[model samples]
Structure formats: structure tokens, C-alpha cells
Target: MDEVSPEETPSQKVPPWLFRAILTGAVALGGLYVLGWLIAELKMLIVIVLVSFFLSFALEPAVNRMERLGIRRGVGTGIMFLALLAAVGLFLWAIGTVLADQIGDFADDAPGYINDIEDWLEDTFDIEVDAQGLLDEFQEGGAVANLATRLADNLINLGATVLQVLFQILTIALFTFYLVAEGPKLRRNICSLLPAERQRQVLSIWNLAIDKTGGYIYSRLILAVISFLVHWLVFWLVGAPFPVPMAMWVGLISQFVPVIGTYIAGALPVIIGLLDQPSTGLAMLIAIVVYQQVENYLLQPKVTAHTMEIHVTVAFGSVIVGSLLLGAVGAVLALPAAATIQAFLASYLERHEVVQELEDAEAAQHPEREPLGDRLRQMLDRVFTPK
Candidate 1:
């Protein structure tokens, strides 16, 4: 074979446009990555938008029902908004009352709790304990003063956070109202952009996502109630202090959190029980474990399956990955995200050529025949009159 000349070399002959395209793609990808990072950094805004979207979907049925009852769309939306506000306010008030009572009880029993802790530590480790000495040392070193200062700072920060949260809620509510009012038009506008052939699939996927998200929210609310009741009953049976308050807190928090939620919720009861009586603490731990098992195997399956078909393994994995990426919020949002992703993938697969072929084959093999009446008439004619 003839040796290739320098000018004719394959690498040298590569088009300039190809190199330009590669460079342009690299820059575009880099910009997109940066943009994604910025969006992640603005997590609070993202959370508000997500909350608004989910709330709109969750409340749509109620709004529609109200409309069916001769209410105008605006009136229906307004009533839903007011109802939501009232519910939130009532929940907050209840939580506040319980927390106040628990705090007072804690204060009244502080000395006893401290003494019990000291006794347990001394006995368990076979060492002398000096609570007074530690306190004196802490005060002398100005640690207590520093702690007070830090607490004050934290309180101020917390107040600011509360204000910010209120603002976000107001924004979300306003946005949710608009979303509910204009959702139909918005949906139509979105579908109008897609090709006619693809619109049905796209709309189906959208419906699947909304239904799944709404179902998940409803199931979680139910689960929270069940968890609260079960925990409260168990705590009362075991004579755990502040059972109602603790159970409510545990239920609400665990519902918001994912994989590690049960453990966190179990911690408070166990600690309080241990402080009161060690044996009760052990019993409380066993109760928590058993209840979680039941919830996972029985309650969760029945409730969540109706909305989104996801495996427990997938849920757990999503939570783990989410936690690694964005802490508690990620873990809380993980299941919905996973379900949405799965819906998209499933819709895509259902539209694929292989899936269509398989379905067609199955249809051909089990072709639907005519009605029994038609078959009977044909059989009678063949038997009585046909030659």
C-alpha cells in the first residue's frame, strides 16, 4: 500500500467545523452545570415552588367539588385557601400548647433528671461523678455566659427564619391560587406545544406524576396520624411521660423525614424513659422497632401502592442518595422525585417499538371474538338451514 502523504493524513484532514462543534458543546455543558449548581444553591426558592405545585394538585379536587356545588372558580379557590390557612394555624397552635406543657414539666423535673443521669453514669462506669464541680468549672471558665450569648444569637436568627418562612408561605399560597385557577389553561398550553401524536403520552405522564404526588401526600398525612395515635397509645400504656406531646412530635417529624426518621423519633421517648426508668426505656425501644416493622410491611404498602408503584428498596435507595446530595430536605423529597423519574421512564418504555410489538403479538394471539348472540345465530343457521 502507498504511504499516506502528510497533507492526506486522517487526523490532519478532520474538518474545522467538527472541532468548533466539540468546543461549543463543551462550553454549553459547562454553563449548564454551573446553572444547575446555582439552582441548587437557591434551594429555599425551589422548595417553595415545589410546595406550591404539590399543594395545588392536592387541593384541586376540593376546588373542583366546590365549583360543582355552584361556586365560581375564584370563590372555590378562595375557600380552599382559607381552609388551608385555618388548618395550618390550628396545627401550629396545638403543637405550641403541647410543647409549652412539655417544657414546663421538663423544668420542674430537671433536678431529678440530672440526679438520675449522674447516678446511672456513676454506677455503669464505676466512677465518681461531680455535677456541681462541672457546673462551677463551666461558670468559672465563662462557658455558661458564652452559651447564653450563643443562645441569644440563635434566637435572633430563629426569629428571622420564622419571618422568612412566613413570607415564603404567603408567596407559595399566592402562587398556588394562580396555579389552581389557571392550571387547565396552563396544561392546554403545554400540550399544544407538543406534536399531536406525542400529546396524549405527555398528558398521561403529567397526570401520572400529579396523581402520584398527590397520593403520596395524602398517604403520608394518614401515616402521620396513624403513627401519632399508635405511639401515643403505646406511650400511655407504658406510662411514659408527655406521651401525647412526644407522640405528636414524633409522628409529624417522622412523616417529613425518610429513612432515618423513625430512629430520630424513637430517640426522644427512649431518652425520657431512660431518665424516668431504664426498663421502660428498653420497652419503648422494642415498641418503636415493632411499630416501624408493621408500618413498613403493612401500612405503607397498602397506602402508597395506590398512588405510585415503587418498591421499598427503591424508596430506601432514593432517600439515601437524596440525603447524600442535599441533607434532610433531599431525603424528604426523594420519594416523589423517584416516582416522577420512574413515571417518565415507564411512559417512554411503553411507547418503545419493542413494547408495541410485544403488545401487538399478545393481542393477535388472544384476538377478541364477536358477541355470544352473533355466534349462536350463525351456529343455528348452519345447523338448521345451511347446506
Candidate 2:
């Protein structure tokens, strides 16, 4: 019987479903590859759109306020852009003027400054440095000539880079203008495609994003103003040249730029002060350090408490992540983005007060002390809300 069955060997067949499954998976994989390629190609476009949307969100509240006062959205958006451009122009003018004058003075007094440096080096460190000789060598070795040549060679690249940057800026500005002007219509169109429940959710999220962005801007502006006033007074007192421009530089850079902003901001004043008087430089440095500590401990917590309410660690982490993803622009966007996400999660998620047991246990572990963050939050809440 075994031999008879063997003699009638059956042919094996592939299942129809198996073939279909293999075909479907191949198609899916092909589709995914094309999708990924498309995304890679459009990455810059995506980033630009995202940035435009962020700017739109930040400007929406002001636009709405203007609308309430009977201004057309388009007009309000245009006004906002003009104001922004004017502010930028003013900042550039201040920076250019200060830098040009300072540089001119430095160049004119270069030999004296070099002699002073040499004297200081000899006096302080018993080290001899022929700065003039070094300068002569640098020039004679054709280093300056090479530098000029390099600059000449790269001039075209620099020009191209500048053009690219300008184009990007204009693209962002155009998109932002449209977004702000047509925000309501955009929202309506988006909601029209969604169900009633989903519409409400989308609208709420949109409004929350706008609030967070606007609040972020407001808080930063207030902090910048305070920083400007404080630094301006110190600079004026120290007889730092171009005190207003320097203070404005410090305020805007320190507030707007993250992480190294303070150091960058302080550099200008420090240099200007040193050029004026050593004692003045030392005093400016001390004042800046003191003000920074005060801001970190007192001012920032109080101001951000009402507006952003984002934890310090979270903000720092967001900035780091953002910088990793998109360099400087990402770093600048990080705060508002983090604030929006944090606010959204806070609103969407359920929360409960800490139990007395947990609090008691924490107190027992750290006897007469509370966390700095918690203390600051509680203190600021009390101060601001003052029952």
C-alpha cells in the first residue's frame, strides 16, 4: 500500500490567498518607499510651512484684537509685518552704527592697544610678546593677502547664501501673511471636513496653540523690557559708550536667543566697558552676573508663572531637542512649541492633587526644605493671585 501511494505522487499547488498576500505586501512596500522619497524631497518646504504656521499662531491674537477694533485682518497683518520690519531695521541700524564706530576706533588705536596688551602681559605674567612683530609677520607672510583672496573666492558663495536666506524669509513672510489673514476661513474649511465632536476638539486645540504662542511672546517681551531697563541703567552708570543700543542688544539677544544668548549679549558691553575703563568692565561684569542670578531666581519664575508655566527642565530639554532638529530656528521655536504641547496635555489629561501621605513622606525625607521649583511656584502663585 505504501508503494502504491508513492507511485501516485500528488502535485503541490500555491494557495491563491498566499499569492494575493505577497502581491499586496510588495505593493505596500513600494508605496512606502515612494512616500518616504517624497517626504525627503519636501522636507525644507515642510519646515518652512511649519514656521509660517507658528508665526501665524503667535500673531493671531493681536490680529484678532485689531479685528475687534474694526480693522480688516489683511490690514492688521500688513501692519504687523511693517512694524516687525521697522523693528528689525532699527536693530540692524543700531548694531551697525555701534560696531562701525567701535571698530574704527579700535583700528585707529590698534598700535596703542597692542602696546598696552604687551605691557599687561609683561607686568602680569612675566611673559614677553612682540605683538607688532607678530602683526608684521602675519602681514609679511602673505596671510592677510591669502585671507583677502579667500574672501574674494567665497564672495559669490556668500552672495548666493544671502539670496537664499532672503528668499526663505520672503516665502515665510508671504505664507504667514496669508495664514493670519485667512485664519478664520482656514479653520472653517478644516472643520467642515470633520465631525461635530472632532470640530470642537480641533478648534479648542487651535485656540490653545494661539494662546500659548501669544502668552510666550508676551512673557518674553515683558522680561526683555525689564532686562533692557536694568542693563541700560547699569551701562549708563558705568559710562559705557552707546548704552542704549548696547542695552537693547543685550535685552533682545538675551531674551530671544537661548542658552548662549546671555554670554553673547554680555560680550558687547564688556568689551565697550573695558575700552572705557578696566574698573567699569569689572563692574559691568559683576552687575550682569548679579542680574542674571536675580532673574533666574526671582524675575523669570514670577513672570513665566502666569504666562508659560513650563518647567525649567522641560524648556531646556525642548530647546536642546529643537536645536538638534533644526539648529537655531528650532531652538527659537522650541519654547512656544513645548508650551503648547504642555498646555495641551495638561488640559486633555486628568489630574489629581497629591495625597497628604505623599507630602508627609516627602517632608520627612527632606525636613525643613522644599524643592526650589515647588517653592517658587507656590510663592509666585500666592503673590500673583493674592487672596
Candidate 3:
């Protein structure tokens, strides 16, 4: 107001250091943006590489044992792969036979199953849901029909892109083969790049990962076998058709796939039950649920903990985190990755025992006015008990 002095605008008179800082930040941000774009572009390749690494780690133990018995690594890997392929081929044939024989029966009986469900709903919930109308709509262009159409379209699109998918698979297999063949040499070369102490640490982590991956496969196989036997017995007692194949399917799928695997395995038997007789379906459902409870509370924690050496909370959390980060692929790889990190940290971190204070222990043991820790302990005991 008082004859405003010749003033420089803020930008025109910016501090030299401030300007330099802004320029540096802009450059860093630009570099980060470029890096992010590159990663997004190559994400599929990244997934393939990770899958190959996981396979190599998982198969390393089998390859090593083969080597110990005087077989070459390359030949051993081939043998293991052939055995796996043959097993898979046999399973597929079993599934095909089951489907071919049973699908027509299921189709023929679907209406009866729907009528039973409709009657049950009316009796129990007093709700009027039109089973036939719904089925007609579903057949004639309802949401289900639309979904089926879209799925068919997607399958066609997938077929168009099959070559690329096959190429990616081939690339992964080749990389895994090479990795297993030269694992020791590769480890030595990598370790040579570090200090002796760091080298030991790296090798220790590598060995731990291999052991854990192999252990994980072994544990899953054991569980799968248990699942197969239990399911086979239940199906046979209930007079379900194709008991062997259905049980085998449940076992393999429930073990290999996470989260929804049990439900998926259970659904087939239930569907067959409904097709045959409504009561049978209900019984099968009850059995599946009961067995699942037993496995969750008794078998799973013991077996998985023994192999993984991780807490139940950690195992569950890792699966969720991995599912979030990498879709299905992440879920499959998360356990081994988490086990490796946990083992590595254990190597370096200090160990300590946590003893409860005497007073706290006394308070925890009190019948009434239970502490939160005591309540939690009780809950855990219930969740983990054999009963």
C-alpha cells in the first residue's frame, strides 16, 4: 500500500536449495512412475518366474535324494516329473469316467432334487420360491444364463490366446528344469558375491526354504490321503455312486486348493446325494461338516505346525495376505515364502522365554472374574482340542 516496493514473486525469488529439492523430488517421482509401469507390463512374466522358483524349491529335496542314490540331477528331475504326470493322467481318467457315467443321471434327477428343496423351503422357512420358474428363467436368459453365455465367450477368447499361455508354461517349465539342475552351482556363485558370514546366512535360508517346501508337500500329501480314506468310507456307507473317484477328487482338490477347496469337494457328494435321494444329501452334508470340524480342530494344526513350524494365526494370515497380493498364484506360494522368512529371522533374532508373573498366573487360574488372557486361552483350547 505504501508504494509497494519492487517485489519478486515467490517462484521468481525461490530459495536455491528449495528449488533443488523440488527438482530432485520431481526426478525421483518420474523414475518411480516409469518403474511402476514397467512392472505392470511385465507382471505375467514375474508370476511365471515366481512359480518356476517355487517348483524348483519344492522339488529340490527329491532331486537331492535321487542324487545321493547315484542318479544324475537331470535324470532324477525327469523321473519325478514323469511320475507326477502319470499320476495326473490316471486321476484325469478316473474323473472322466465318473463324469461320463454320472452326469446323465444328475441331469435326469435335477428336477426332483429341486422339488424336494422347494418343499423343504416351504415347510421350514414358509417361503414360496418358484423352482420351475427360476429354472426356466435360468435356461431362458436370466442372470445365470447370461453368465453362462459370457463364460462361453470368455472361453472362446481364451482359446484365441492359448498359444501365449502355452508359451508361458513352456518357459516356466524350462526355467524350473534349469534351476533344479544347477541349483548348487547357482547358490555357490551367489554366495561368492557376499561376505563369508553373509554367505552362510544366505545358504542357511536357502536350505531352510528347500526343506520347508518339501515338508509342505509331504504334509499335504498325508492330509490328502487321510481325506481320501475318510471320504471313501463315508461315501461307501452312504451308497453314493462313484465313491472312489469322488473321494479321490475331494482328497486331491481339497489338499491342493486353499480356502474353498473343502466346500467344492463336499458339494459334489451333496449334489449326487440330492440326485439320488434328498435324505442322503442331507446326511452327506452333515458328515462333511463333521469331518471338516475334526480336521480343523485336531489334525490340521498338529500336522501343519509340525511341518511349517509356524503359528496357526501366522499360517492363516499368510494365506489371506498372499491371496490379496497375487490372486490365486500368491495363495499357492505364500506358505513357503512365509516359512523361509520365519526361518531366516529365527537364525538372526535373539531367543527368549516369556514367563508369566506369579500374580498374573494366579489371577488367570481363578474360576470367576477371568482375565482376557485366560478367556483367550480357553477359546484357543476349544479351537484346538481333539473333541
Model 1's TM-score against the true structure: 0.72
For residues 149-260, write the lDDT of model 3, one tens digit per residue: 9999999999979978889878988999888998999999999899999998888888998988888888888899998899889988988778898889888888778777
Q: Cα lDDT of model 2 overall?
A: 0.90
Best by lDDT: 2
Better of 2 and 3 by lDDT: 2
Q: Name the candidate that leads on TM-score.
A: 2
lDDT of 1 by residue, 147-208 (tens): 99999999999999999988987899988998887777888998999999789987787677
Residue-wise lDDT of candidate 2 within 108-187, one digit each (tens)? 99989789989999999999998878989999999999999999989989999999999999999999999999999999
Clashes of 2: 0
TM-score of each predicted structure versus truth: 0.72, 0.84, 0.77
- lDDT of each structure? 0.81, 0.90, 0.85
Candidate 1 stretches greater than 4 Å from native: 1-19, 26-30, 33-43, 82-91, 111-147, 351-387
**By the TM-score metric, which is better: model 2 or model 3?**
2
